[model samples]
Target: MSAPSHTTSYYAASANDKNLRPALQGQVEADICVIGAGYTGLSTALHLAESGFKVVVLEATRIGFGASGRNGGQIVHSYSRDIDFIEKHYGDKAGAEMGKMAFEGGKIIRRFVDQYNIQCDLKDGGIFAACNGKQMRELESKKALWETHGHNNLELLSDTDIQKYVGTTRYKGALLDKSGGHFHPLNLVLGEAAALESLGGVIYEDSPVTRVEEGAKAKVHTENGSVSANFVVVAGNAYLGGLIPKLQAKTMPCGTQVITTEPLSEAQQKALLPNGQCVEDCNYLLDYFRLSGDGRLIYGGGVTYGAREPDKIESLIVPKMLKTFPELKGVKIDYAWTGNFLLTLMRLPQFGRVSNNIYYAQGYSGHGVTCSHLAGKVLSDAIQGQAERYDVFAGLPQYPFPGGRTFRIPYTAMGAWYYTLRDKLGI
Candidate 1:
């Protein structure tokens, strides 16, 4: 198999450092073997390595090459399905347990950056912009709900108050979560990989796992080599492909587009985001934008349900950006790209065991940025004989899309269209 390079995007271009890790070459042994070098895998590897476990990580491409590297970089709290849904579906006790861990992902990310001194262009604060009164009410309700979970760093901004943070008239109000923020994602993941290596963990890039031979001891086979370990973790997410047939039906890959504009003048930057905080609207098919450390406007929106790329992503996204900030009609797009994120049928992440010794976690839906880091801790805990946190996710029911793999894309696409229309109508 050919080695893959990082996608052409702002994160790749501004990456603080690159890891030219060599591919797997021969048979190896470890206490644990991890597949994929994205946030979840690297986080799990780092945590376990710190716990004195001999771990090895294999990546099909570069570290953070998946959604971790290419996402909007907004580190929001909770899952895509929302805490209320969890309470209603799983009962009060389960929901409260989940809410307790909800804010920890961001904390873990901050701890990693501070502990390792990772230079990921970290920033502070994120806003949930509301486009209408209905959404504003929703934001208020969301703020209240989150506050009940002990998340106190939340502020509800009215239409008058929102303007100080964002330069857009499209939003009626906003919810400001000071704990939520943004960063240079690629650099952060790279930093984690380096930290793992420094802790005596081994990582091999461009070594895609062809298959996992499951048994008392799971053997992970790659194109050039194999790893026989007491435990195996599959963290490939949307890019896992057909390595495990059972996982394919449980998660579907969806694509989202993003574009970064040429650096704006200091005045223009202030006019757009005066506080330099990341902002994402309340719409289901939402628009998210923030200023790069260097002053470029990085905006992303629109979803392709089947993981299909638009021939001209810039054309598809620029109109949305201009609608939010019409003053940017003349801004040149410096980079445009799309990446896939795994979406479960219920919009919640799916976690379960493929075999007693073979564990997997994927389908973060659209909440991979922060949740993936949290998931790493959960996976590591489960592996280290601490199953309390992991079982919370594993116990949640994950169902296949209504129509299964063959028709799931079209089914979900129709649902997105309906919600997109509802968002437009402010319903």
Candidate 2:
């Protein structure tokens, strides 16, 4: 089969820098070898390199070429999974710890952007809007749970307050998080990658890991070359493919489609999002949107569990955008694209070792932007012989998709249909 093509999104056209790093050739050795130059791998490489470890990152494509670069750029404060779900499955102590991790994950992202002087258009306002009373109640419950853990940055907003911020009457209420915001996701990833290189880390783009030999020392194979390292970290997430058979079975691919409109007038931009806040409605399959630095409306929200791209992604997403802001009736969509992300059955990130020297992290379940950053830090710590944080995620049980590889597409489609129905029925 041929390799998958990159998404044709506005991000690609307006990328911060377009320098392509050469792929791996011949052979090399390092203290740590990371696969996938997306957020997880790049962050792991960056942190490990800063710690004085010789690190090399292998990317199937260029850095941020996957969901890391193409996502809606919302810096949400929690995982895609519900906190109640975590509490019910794991005990209170474990649940609370996971909650803390989710909360701290957002902080970790902001801290890195600040410390590294990353110019990713960082902002600090986000809202989880409620479209109905039920969602409002859910948001309130979430607020209480967060408050229980001393997370006071969350503010519950009424319909009136919500309107003031979002300039839309469709939402009944909202949960505003002052600590959460949005940014240029691709820029952030690239900045981190550059930072990693500055710390003497090596990065090889277009170097897909074809196989892994796990033991005390692991060897990661590419098409033309390989890296033999003391520790190997698999941060490929959705793009991992068959590198590790077990890891692939635990998560299925889901495609997310997005589009950006031609730059709106300054006045028009403000009228849509008054405070320049990033907003998403409270729903299982959610719509997330934010105004770009130059005023284009970057809107995203549809999910396809299948690996193939939808024949008409723009038509599928544009109507949804119009539903929210009918004011942009005649606006032209400048770009449309889709990216595949991994959705694990448990909704929690999957982290564990194929062997003592081979560690892997994936299944952020759409929370990869921030969680991957945290995953990188945690994975780096584990590589350095500290396993407390790593163990927390690795302890989470992961069930393989029931239908195996052949039936994964159909199974995911059926499951997505159920959620789509719920979202439509407002259940």
lDDT of each: 0.91, 0.86
- For 1-427, candidate 1 gives per-residue lDDT tens digits of 4568998888999998764889899999999999999999998899899999999999998898899899998899999977888999999988998999888899999999999999987899999999989999999999999999999989999898999999988889999999989998888999999899889999998888898998999999999999999999999999999898888988889999999999999999999999999999999999999998899999998898544344489878999999999999888898999999998888898888999998888999899988899999999999889999899999998887777778888898899999999999988
Q: Give the Å shift of residue 90 in candidate 2.
A: 1.5
Q: Which regions of candidate 2 fall more than 4 Å away from where they truly are?
A: 1-6, 307-311
lDDT of 2 by residue, 1-427 (tens): 6444456778778778788888899999999999988889988898899899999999998788888998999888667775667878887777877877777667777877888888888888999999888899999999998787767888899999987888778898999988889999888898898888889999998888888987778888999999999999988888888878889989987898888999999888888899999998877788999998889999988788643343477788888888989998889888888888899887788999889888899998888888888899999999998888888888889899887888878887887789878877778
> Model 2, 377: alpha-carbon shift in Å?
0.9
Predict model 1's lDDT versus the native. Answer: 0.91
The true-versus-predicted C-alpha distance at residue 323 of model 2, in Å, is 0.6
**Superposition error at 212 for model 1 (Å):** 0.3
lDDT minimum window of 10 residues, candidate 2: 305-314
RMSD of each: 1.2, 1.8
What is the Å distance of residue 341 in model 2 from its true position? 1.0
Scanning candidate 1 in windows of ten residues, the lowest lDDT window is 305-314
